[model samples]
Target chain A: DTAVSQTPKYLVTQMGNDKSIKCEQNLGHDTMYWYKQDSKKFLKIMFSYNNKELIINETVPNRFSPKSPDKAHLNLHINSLELGDSAVYFCASSPTQRGNTGELFFGEGSRLTVL
Target chain B: DQQVKQNSPSLSVQEGRISILNCDYTNSMFDYFLWYKKYPAEGPTFLISISSIKDKNEDGRFTVFLNKSAKHLSLHIVPSQPGDSAVYFCAFGNEKLTFGTGTRLTIIP
Candidate 1:
């Protein structure tokens, strides 16, 4: 069984279109995060949620929004996507900060291509 | 500004040799650093990590050495095998985690 899973492994959409990527983790972790890996291969943190509370939001465009329905799920929704938004999005989960090893269990990234 | 930087985009090493991948960071406040490995079409996996209080951490054939004064850290894989070929990323954790662009390590037979 996959620890962390994201839907729509590959997506190709037109600019200005709206899309959402759903992520779920069965690891019983308290913290979940979204990360973007651009063309340069740099992994940038977009947002983080701990037990359904928003935390660690980076400076990203307002078009990108993250929703956490529970501690085991975090979903990313993009409105009016642009070409610059084409990248691989990764969903990760980890144990809470205290007594944690800082190890992030990541999902096989969802690749988004905006044309 | 890129806080974490992996200057070498790619590196090639002969099999059974030591493969060293380097990373540098501008932030001295990062409390912990980690090395992650990734293969094509896969998410990066945690390889090893070291804390700001320690200079080195080793696990099996993989070792991570951190030099806080120089703001640099490196991952060394001794006697590298073909399966060890992958893109390596170094990340620093403070309030949040910041990652470098990553260095692709190629092990040639």
Candidate 2:
């Protein structure tokens, strides 16, 4: 079973368009996170949610928002996508916010391309 | 500022040899560290981890060593196989996880 899964694996959109990526986890984890991997392969945290409560919000632009409907789902929405928004977005989940194991289960990742 | 940094962009190792990947961090608050491996078209999977309290952790062919004083950590793979070729990332975890730029490992037979 896929512990963490994200939909719209590949998205190609034009500038100024809006898009959303959906993510879900079945590992009974309490924390979920959205991460962006740029072209240089640098993974940076965008947002984190614990039990549907927003916890960590990196210095991401307001144009990007993350919503967690439940403990098991976290979705990312991009408003007025720009070329700089093109990158791979990863969804991850952990058993706890401060996981002693320090391990996260990650989804296959959603690749976004803005022209 | 990037708290975690992997200076090596790529490392090529011959089969049956040891592969050493190094990572450094600037945050002293980060008490937990982890290593993850990712293949093309796939998300990273957890490989091994070490806490600040310990200096080394071993799991089969993978071993992670931590140097708290220098804030340096390294992952060692013994007899690296071709299948071990992938991009490896080192991460520090506190309130949130911070990842270093990945280092791509190529194991040549």
| DockQ score of each predicted structure, in the order shown | 0.66, 0.78
TM-score, each model? 0.97, 0.98
RMSD of each: 1.0, 0.9
User: TM-score of the candidate numbered 2?
Assistant: 0.98
Q: Which one is best on lDDT? A: 2
Q: Categorize the docking of model 1.
A: medium
Q: Which ten residues in a row have the lowest lDDT in candidate 1 chain B?
A: B89-98
The 10-residue segment of model 2 chain A with minimum total lDDT is A95-104
Question: Candidate 2 regions off by >4 Å?
Answer: none
| lDDT for B82 (candidate 2) | 98
iRMSD per prediction, in order: 1.7, 1.2
Rate residue B65 of model 1 by lDDT.
95
Off by over 4 Å in 1: none
**lDDT per residue, candidate 1, A1-115, as tens digits?**
9999999899999999999999999999999999999998889999989999998889988899999999999999999999999999999998884446577889999999999
